[model samples]
Target chain A: MIWKYICGSASSPLSVSFSERPRDGQVIFNSGVYLIGVKSGLLALSARCPHLGCQLAYNAADRRFQCPCHGSQFSLKGHRLKGPAKKEMTVLELRQDHECEGYKVIF
Target chain B: MQQTADYGQQTTDNNHGQRTTDNGPRTNYGQLALWAFHVALLTGVILSFHYRPWGDVFKSVSKISGWLPYGDFLRKLHYLAGQCFLILSFAHVLEHFLKETYRRIRPKEWSRLVLLFSLGFPLLFTGFILKGDKEGILAGEVMYHLAQEIPLIGSGLARMLLRPGEEFFLLPYLYHTVILPLTVIFLLDRHTRRLLPRGDWGWPFMAFLALLATFFPLPPDIPPYMEISHISGPWFFHGVQLLLRQVPPLWAGVIWPVIPLLLTALLPFAPPKLSKWGKRLTMAAWLIHGMILVAAWL
Candidate 1:
């Protein structure tokens, strides 16, 4: 009972609504996940670095995600560019929300 | 045979009678460091009573810092003492290194000291992460990934060190509060060959830590959204962080840190000429590490 309370219940998908489509190169953080607005569509990415799991920060000026830990860099589209990170950033599934105007991000 | 006799004499001289010298302090740095570790362990026990390893760890720590009476004092003391333990242990090793006495200690005993010193990093690092601030959380994740870089056992090692769960705090907390302290105490006992610390430095150091803790509290937690590119890891980690920027993860994260450690481990076992070279290489590594640390900070 205590473990369940502390760990919390299984998480539900998070829905985020936007007044309009997010601007290209824009990044939004919702429910511990980051969503990047790209030409392809909204790319829901984990803030975790694929190299060594450092928290990644999206650099707006460079339009790249930078990891402070090992200096790994990823593109705006979650592609690994440089440093120790071997794989592309983990992308979460995004589904259109019928009831809500935005998308449901499955974490 | 002669070396063995010399080692026996040195061990007896160092460990047995006359802990104090006419010129030297009542306690040596090795003893002082063990005392500091004791203080850190005691204060850590107190802090653990209030610290929650699940849910919003940052918020839990914030409450302990702000709301709990004397909680901040205990927390700061734990932090300060842990740092002192590492610093003083380094001083003890430096003293031995400079006097060329490290080679006189039995190879097994000397290796124990090496292992003890090496263990201090992860122990302190885990404690640093338990604070659950932006830096701490990120650092914890970095540690997890670094562990994963270990090849076959990487993922398992990572899980053992820091099991993924609520805020990734449970395994770190377990290691910090329980496993690490026990292991440190056991190693310290074998290295010091003493069940209790010499009271001389212990009491004074505790008083110093208490005063320090009273006046100086830990810095406030920075939110994750704040610019973190400028933020670095713990002090000892600065050099590695700088190296990571220039090299691949396997080299910077694994091989680089291991070089100095490997050299230090070789000190007691090597022949005279080889030992001298080992010492030189270790010192050079430290000097380079210092430069890298400065570069990272800059």
Candidate 2:
């Protein structure tokens, strides 16, 4: 019971526009979320690292998200590149909103 | 007959009623560590008066450094004294390992000393978290998730140590100021048969720290959003920090730290061969950890 309370995510769904997305290979942080513009598409990732939840910092030069605490690295597409983290970065569900020309990110 | 109590020399009555010299426990790093603990406790108490745990803890700490009279000096002194206490305590344990003092001491007392040594981690770490700086906050978060990596009870334990979705400093402040110090004091008295060190071994250490505080004020706290590529935890955590890069958190955070404590616990009761193996493993672990620490720094 208490575990559920402690582990539960606090963020709600966020709607971000296509224009607001970062350029290719770049990442923009908006309200605890990382919106990365990868070569394929926009990837919305939770800023918290899966390993120890230390905030991940995007290295534009290296084009990888690095965990400052434990050195877990993820690709621009949110794939696990190097780890202590056994899992890839948590990608929120993105639904296209034709009306707003944007996507609804379910955190 | 009259005798002098000096170093390891002590006079004891032989079976024939003649006085004979016996080697007692000598003054060692343990005593010096205790003295450092005393200084740390004193300065911690004084510094607590100026520290505000509620609302904008970073700014509150900044005020202690920038606004209050001699607050910066006192804070630095407290930080240095705490570090010395931890380092000297480890050195004392190392000296014991080298001397095989555990063999001579009663198993119960040795076990108590082991517990005392283990307590140093939380005592020091909670204080580090209470600083409310970027490194400290991230370190606390790391600890939380590390604790959460345990199988069944992880979440409960993590929540107990650090309240999730809550202001960070309150619980850590309580642990740092009250619970840990009292536990340390009790264990120190039980293990050493005295709470305070004899003579003034601590004064020189304190003097050195005072001089250091005068010259080297702690670096200003940086905000979390800064483009700092690497955030290091406390110096003692470097090895684990590096290890976490290579292994899973369950191994790096939980199992690795517990291995030494388990070995220390088993040493007194294990068979001679097992004890020898335990000692060897402990030494190897420290060596690897030292190398890893160096690697993390580089």
Candidate 3:
């Protein structure tokens, strides 16, 4: 099954709002590119490295989001690879658009 | 501080694993620092009694003539005490780092130590700028701009912040010298008690009171006032500020708050294993920080 969101207002693809609770990964909308780790069946978490608070990017080659500051790594599903942070990566929400032309976020 | 601790119940009799050997040397270092602090406090108080924050007589300690009893000694003591206070506070930090006092204390205690440091420096800032001399004026300028750097509420606060409106200096100097400093002292006493529950710091503290009785001593008086040419809030603060000065304003002011959070998370999982090497690194950092402090002072 494919997920589709139909938002009302006219907005750019990146402008759509996507947010999820900590339990489910949180989707943070931003101007910069973020490597979000999404499990279609389960969760979505913003791709930023919580350490040093750097915006995280997906390293497709490595299949993980790497933090620029101090280099902490997180798995695609938001599981933390190491310490320094007592907790795991935050989870957010996401839905797969089976076939939406543009990434317009809907409520 | 006492109230916060005693309520939890202190049990010195826990003999299961206690080290009560009075080797005396370990305690002596702490005691020496305490002695210095007492002397400084003494000087600061007496000098404050004769000192006028701002007035025409500032050109010379003249109007303060044959006036209030022991005025001269009070003034001298103030300057000397300030120097002593600065030295002890710094030495205390270094000694703690060496002995790893930070390791055994409860996190709550470390947090209190941080808070005391943050508050203590501000008191020193107030004391300096209120003097209204060259250093005071220069210090005030730095403070005014720094306040502006605060987020949402900074603009209004910084603009109206005290200075003599005459453009040459700020007015109502009482805010820095008397009002703010007193508030800091009150808070600091409560804080100190919490860290050293059974320890009594009074006698040594009183010695600082005595030192405040000595001379018409003024600081080096280097650099012009109101120019903001050099930034000297208090020596302890100056070191931090100087380190930041090496970087751009955006980096120092904006990026700094974020750095700690990132470092905390990234450091543990850092490539370096949490072994003897990690401990060594932390110690190295301590030494490096001290060296930097000395470098800045020089």
Candidate No. with top TM-score:
1
lDDT of 1 by residue, B1-298 (tens): 1111112122324542332222232226777787888888888887888899998888889889889898888889989989988888777666666666665556776677778888888889999899888888877877887788788999899888886655489999988888888888888777755647764556878888899999995866786556566556788888888887777777787778878877776788788768778889889987787788788777
TM-score for the first chain of model 1? 0.74
- State TM-scores per candidate: 0.84, 0.83, 0.48
Q: In terms of lDDT, which candidate is stronger, 1 or 3?
A: 1
Query: Each candidate: how many clashes?
Result: 0, 0, 26
lDDT of each: 0.74, 0.74, 0.46
Error of 3 at B89 (Å): 3.0
Q: Which whole-number lDDT from 0 to 100 does residue B192 have in model 1?
A: 58
Sort order, lDDT high to low? 2, 1, 3
Residue B62 of model 1, lDDT score: 86
lDDT of 3 at B152: 86
The CAPRI class of candidate 3 is incorrect
Write down the lDDT that model 1 would get.
0.74
